[model samples]
Target: MTKFYSLGDSESEQKRLLRQIDLYGDTRGVAFGAANRVVELGCGAGANLWIARQLSEGSYVGVDVRQGQIDAARRRTRDLGIGNAEFQLADAAETGLKAGDFDALFCRCVLIHQPDPRPIVTEAQRLLRPGGRGVFIEPDGPNHYMAPGKEALMKVFHARTHYAYGDGRGSPGAARNLYPLLVNAGFKDVTLTPHVIVATGDDADCCRAFLRHWMEIIAPVADALVAEGLITSRELKQALREAETVKPDLFICHTMWQADATR
Candidate 1:
């Protein structure tokens, strides 16, 4: 089965993800400045690649398993007249990129969808030169929020998504723990930085869009949950109704980390 992260919802979520990436910049200091030659793993739609090419002034390659996304990315790059970026169809856990072929490896909102993120890190380490770094950004599900009527629904929403789709890993708050994983995989000087991107003011529109996107993703399971009495129908209806009226205090603590480890 094509995973939810590789499906249509994620395709639509790309724009919101782009805005978050813009806030974080290309990669961390390790991948910035003199670093060149970059690869984006799970580069859905090529948004990050576009930004990364601009920041690093380097050749950028993006890989994804979805051919649809690769096609979309190609079209976007061509439309934008961006010549330094390219897209390919490849798997995140097993991209056939050459060893030491890239100075930096970038993945955003990708690893959490994997069945095992360790191999993804392992491959990233292999792709990087001795001092090359990997930048990974993921959402901190625990920090996601809702109002009083929707609080319980939000909790269940996150739990079901994390437990079912999170690959038995909590990448959201895994930023700190990834340091050890990188070190164990023979990556040296592994470090992590926690970041939060607030959605406010005119950005409220973006938040509203994101909320709708997530609601669409959760709708199937939510109906099941209500059917099984996991959540009351009345509660679900209230939350759905409130989704429109609630003053959008959209905040996502993107537990992103930039890890630099040498080969």
Candidate 2:
């Protein structure tokens, strides 16, 4: 789908993600204490996998559909001497990992790409042991962040991008929708923890990085904005320029749903 994450060189994006993760509080989403083995879906370049390995002192497996991404992750694990972590090329909907094989599952910014998150959520539920937890994190849609005038163009660009890339329904409106969806997948004791990117001075650079990446991601769609009548080509260009110039508010609220299912 929209591989906005694959915008830059693998290493650069990896470092950026690691920094963002650290800024947002690394250990909060991690489920430990009785949990040992952890599996992270859409584990690009092993950033979170590396952290999870240290947090658990147990087995860690990262699954992604792309072989190139998997290879990159493998190299990263070896370079870091993270023996506890491994990478596998597999779809989250059907990873073929044994039922109840993982003590916990971590998914971040990946479910939006799936046409149907139901299968993935169902698989996650099946993969976890009874009382085990699964944490799902995703960006609240682009519409949530932009101004009313900017929001219209952003939506058009997002839709066109999805059509161009064959991705279904860009991201969900917010992480809040995840709680009910998880419950539908048969998860219990579900707790939805919402997280927003705190964009302080130090966090500004990272926010800017994401904005640049987003511009690239929506480039194709921007080209068609005029034809679609959603926004003029000039307006689209201005939006891109402004996105780069203006600093994203440190108080911007982007919700990430971290749900813990007992079992």
**Candidate 1 lDDT:** 0.64
| Model 1: per-residue Cα lDDT over 63-148, one tens digit each | 88888778877877887777778776888767887888987777776765665678888888888887776776665555665544
Give the per-residue lDDT of model 2 (tens digit) for 171-232.
45425568777888888888866666544334667666545555655664565656767567
Q: Which candidate tops lDDT? A: 2
Cα deviation at 47, candidate 1, in Å, is: 1.9
- Candidate 1 collision pairs: none
- The parts of candidate 2 lying over 4 Å away from their true place are 1-31, 146-167, 200-210, 216-230, 247-251
The local lDDT score (0 to 100) that residue 124 gets in candidate 1 is 86
What lDDT score belongs to each candidate, Candidate 1 first?
0.64, 0.65
Model 1 bad stretches (over 4 Å)? 1-31, 55-57, 166-173, 199-210, 216-221, 224-230, 248-260
Clashes per model (N, Cα, C within 3 A): 0, 2
Write out the backbone clash pairs for model 2. 131-263, 132-263
